[model samples]
Target: MAPTHSDHHHHNDGKKPPPKLLTLPTILTIGRVAAVPLLVATFYVDSWWGPNATTVIFLAAAITDWLDGYLARKMKQGTAFGAFLDPVADKLMVAATLVLLCTKPFEAGVFGQAPWLLTVPAITIIGREITMSAVREWAASQDGKLSEAIAVNNLGKWKTATQMTALTILLATRDGSLIGEGTLLASGVVLLYISAWLSAWSLVVYMRKIWKVLLM
Candidate 1:
């Protein structure tokens, strides 16, 4: 019989295995976390790049969020640490960007003339993230699978999609870099509210699933 691919694996019998924390996927995940500081620095650069640079950097970092997971699964490089850190990286990106836009008071308001519009959506999204993280952490400390049950769902993914897109657009508007009409800021604000709605929906779903467990 011909030698099979698996049969060739015996050649590495003497080698030490690499550390779990050093995998390529995990490295990419770490890069995403590091990008947050870079993003913040770009905001204060005081140059032509301004929010334009942030938009590009933020978009790249956001893409890494999906790319890291895809590479992890495709390369079979997933680790326990990678699983834990990936979502933490994601939450950090979203929360930091939203807080930057909402509190910085860009031109009187971050996205709109109405003070509460941007504030409400930012708070909604941020609050839901913090709450869900606490809930999932507590659930994991109890029953391991309990957290997985309420883990990232379709709605949660949609919330991230909308949230990332909205923030990207909102930031772009700050430097007068709108892709279309002058109403891009307003559009971003509207999408932010939509994302927040989805954020709230996902939180409610997670809480309902674990409410009984939490009561005990």
Candidate 2:
């Protein structure tokens, strides 16, 4: 009875695809992605660098997360390529750190090593990221502007802040920068679990919003 939005997009031509990838904002995003391997390598490899190296590098990279977005807006260089690459880099960093935390687990006395609890949060965070990416792609294919309906919201920002803070603190546990080991590592785990909870809540919110639009 009704043509889908996908049918309408086929006839449209106004919105432009991303231009060349030479923009400063795009370069910053690319740099963020590039640092991911070094982040993981230093964290596990240990011998190559000092104890707190991962924490310092991670927090530095996290700063770029905000800087790139701010520059993209201030510099007027918000290309589709930057939009896509930014989140991909963030998710890559989060996933790598989560794997390390899960493998190591939280070190509580009676509880011993509880890798499964760490794993639950990792799955929750990664699964939500994957689901939202697919939704955005499909919505864009339907109507180029529709995907913005579920773009990064405030809740997503909180989730990311908690994620970055927790991951950085966890990595810092290798040294007593902020009094690590029991105190800092435990706090990091608690914050991470909180971020994971927020991640699930945000996922539900986005899915509901998109579902209503999809059915229309």
Q: Residue 185 of model 2: what lDDT? A: 74
Could you tell me how far off, in angstroms, the CA of residue 5 lies in candidate 2 after the best superposition?
Answer: 37
Question: Residue 103 of model 2: what lDDT?
Answer: 70
lDDT of 2 by residue, 1-216 (tens): 799986667558546553667688788889888988888777776463544677777887799989989999998889888988888988898888788767765455334767586788899998888887887778778774467667778998899999999888877775444543677777777888999999999988888888777787
lDDT of 1 by residue, 87-163 (tens): 99988988888878866655533334565667888889889888887877788787765776676789977888889
Best by lDDT: 1
- Give the top-scoring candidate (TM-score): 1
Worst 10 residues of 1 by lDDT: 106-115
Cα deviation of 59, candidate 1, in Å: 0.3
